[model samples]
Target: MSDLNRWMQKHNLCPENILYLYRSDRKTVLHRMDGGEAALYAPMHGVLSVLPEDQFLNISKGIAVNRSQIVNIGNDGVYTMSDGRTFQGRKRGLSSHRRLRMEIGLSDTKPRPMSMSLLEKCSLLDDMPLAFCVIELVFNEDGHGVDFIFRYCNAEMANIEGVPVEEMLDRSFYKVFPNGDKKWLVSYADVALNGTKHTLHDYSPEVDKYLTIHCYQPEPGYCACVLQANEP
Candidate 1:
């Protein structure tokens, strides 16, 4: 297992249990749902560096939070934690906070049943020959793009990546493929934020192959990419 995963397992830190991390004195303290705090013997930046990017939202230089633990966001850049503590972040953090709140709300909500015809029409995409996937651009609470989460992937996409669709769904793209090019990350974020289409040819170290990708936003905050494996 990776160091990050091992650290998470060592501390028993899971999404439902971890509240947030705060810098206190010379150490970084991890706050838990059970009303306990553990001081990590590392610099705040070091601790933040090891955290799973998709799971932690940095509210400020000294505060990082689990998006799921946020209860509500108030005007003037104040956020109420699930444990009822309020943290006022910088004014610049407000936009990112609101975006995170909206993303969480959408994910937690259940979609209404669609008409049978509509469902059938949507299913047609699954039969497409091209490898397809939808990615959610993750951001820090300060409004900077950090990483990406795989929201959906078709069987062809999974096969092309040599992973199961179930394994890719809702998992951090970086965690799965740590060697992914930074250029791809930039392109994904641009398409997600600007609603423009981008096409690129890149080599995937993970799959030991080259790939041609066309990326575009299906909606704000989400990117849909179609991949084609290129000749060696």
Candidate 2:
């Protein structure tokens, strides 16, 4: 484990007060408007996952700035912050936010996607405090695991991934996280394909959080995973 994982502490900050996030090596330093810094040993993208998507956008692959902190977003792929600091946001990120602006005029373009079979089995679990999701396994012709698509995601599951509930539904796990650990596919596949119920404790260096994942097959080719995370 990295030093961040060996010694993790929780820091609660108001989302609005966050000014910018800068990643140095594997540690992400949250530079606040008040000159305070909260450091987390986590991947940049992983940290971005838990922020308010509407308020935070990646300036570059290595940096994400709060929308409130931006002084102006220039047409030249550069953004200036209220703190007199400027950084280049990725063109793809800017385009995505432009698309996000387009989504404002539209309302719920599609209904939330869910798997009835998984939903039924999920109801059997009486865990109100944990985050959980039901996912369908995607496989290659060789029957090996490739990815899992979200069939049903509870609100808490969205909090875990730092995405909104509607945004996660019916989305590919790899699509959202292109470089997500392959071990996750293996773990979920073991439960879904073989009905092997199990649990695992994992520490995410990227998000600087500890996780306990409880997995079970809700139906063939589908599994439900209960997630509990903290900065302990």
Report residue 102 deviation for candidate 1 (angstroms).
12
Among these predictions, the greatest TM-score belongs to 1
Report the lDDT tens digits of candidate 1 across residue range 76-169: 4566564446676667757776676676763222222333553354356786888888887664443223467887677798778988888888
What C-alpha lDDT does candidate 2 achieve relative to the native structure? 0.66
- Cα lDDT of model 2 by residue, 1-232, tens digit: 4343333334545577678999886788888765678887788777666668988877677888887555344444465554445676677656654443344321122223455664776665534567888887653322222467888777687677777768777878777666566556556766765688879888754335688888998776677888889567
Q: Model 2, 3: alpha-carbon shift in Å?
A: 50
Worst 10 residues of 2 by lDDT: 104-113
| Candidate 2, residue 209: lDDT | 69
TM-score versus the correct structure, for each prediction: 0.49, 0.45
Candidate 2's displacement at residue 27, Å, is 44
* Candidate that scores best on lDDT: 1
